[model samples]
Target: MSKTNAARILDRLKLPYEILEYAVDPDDLAAESTAEKLGLPPEQVFKTLVARGDRHGVCLAVIPGSAQLDLKALAVLAGDRKTDTVPLKDVQPLTGYVRGGVTALGTKKAYPVYVDELMLTFETVAVSAGKRGLMLWLAPQAYLTATQGIVGAIARSSPP
Candidate 1:
């Protein structure tokens, strides 16, 4: 299998991780859908979101499929008046990855990264391996360390 941006970052950081690949329909894959396809719990899978902070250039948020990013919390963490998610068009050039394939690591620029504190509860967490149909399972701390991510309670329950 080809190494993804996430895998490349992990390898560069010398962190141990396992890559998992499965069939995925790029047009229809969602975090929840990917989790189901891989036979993994939704909470174990995370999605990477790029947000624009009022003063903080660009920031990355990592949250479980079962949770939602708390914009207010992120604003506070970023010390900004507010924060807004970057649109799909802007994300690719900024992060050098498509919406469903963005990884916290290997972005075009080194933006501040935040990972939901809840992820620490799991021994291993899965994140996009920089492409559709691929994921990586590794210690959450390893991910944080590799990305220089800040841990915070920046996630909220998903809407019904």
Candidate 2:
């Protein structure tokens, strides 16, 4: 398969990573499904979210697929009083990546990235490869370096 922008960046940086591809179910864009496909735990798979802060124009937040972003807490971390996810229609235009395939590592816009502190619990985490059906797996530190990500308690367990 051809390299995605994210893969290219990782290669250029000489950061080791594994690329995993699975069948895409357009109807099911959830990250958890992808994790299952890769034989990884849901918590090890992260999904990227784009949010607009009252003060910051836009930024990317990544959290475990099984959890949901804590917008109020993220606002505090972002130094903004409030923050909301960007509209679905605008996600592609804003980040050059459609839903189910957004990665902050190599986006159209270089927005600041914040990864959930929980990610550090694992030796490696998996994120989108900037394409549907593909995932990038690498050490958390390497991911932080590649995406310039800040680690914090940005997510909490989502209700079942």
Candidate 3:
């Protein structure tokens, strides 16, 4: 497969990563499913979310596939009083990535990136390759450095 903008950015940074592709199930775009398809546990896969802070405008929140973004926690980290996920209709225009394909590496703009501290526990984490059906696997620290990500407790366990 041709390289994606995310991969290109990694190359420019001289970071090593592996691209893995799976069959895309349009009906099941959940990160959990993506992890399953890749034979990985959900927490090993990170999903990027777009959130708008009342003061900071837009930022990226990356959390484990099995967790959910904690808006309040994110707001604290972004230094905003309030934050909410951007509307679905605004996601593509804002980040140049569709729902299932969003990644913090190479967005349309360099929005501040907030990554859940959980990712640091793993040697490598999987994130979208700027498109659906494709995933990028790299050392968490390398990915964080590439995106200039801020680490924080910005995610919470999904409700049972």
Best by lDDT: 3
Taking the tens digit of each residue's C-alpha lDDT, what string does model 1 give over 24-108?
7878768888898889998899999999998887999999988888999999987889998988899999998887788888898
Error of 2 at 17 (Å): 0.3
Model 3: residues with Cα > 4 Å off, grouped in runs = none
2 against 3, candidate with superior TM-score: 3
lDDT of 3 by residue, 1-160 (tens): 9999999999999999999999999999999999999999999999999999999899999999999999999999999999999999999999999999999988888999999999999999999999999999999999998999999999999999
Q: Which runs of model 1 end up more than 4 angstroms from their true locations?
A: none
Against the true structure, candidate 3 has what lDDT?
Answer: 0.96
Per-candidate TM-score against the hidden true structure: 0.96, 0.98, 0.99
- Per-prediction RMSD in angstroms? 1.0, 0.7, 0.5
What is the descending lDDT order?
Answer: 3, 2, 1
Which number leads on TM-score?
Answer: 3
Alpha-carbon shift of residue 33 in model 3 (angstroms): 0.2
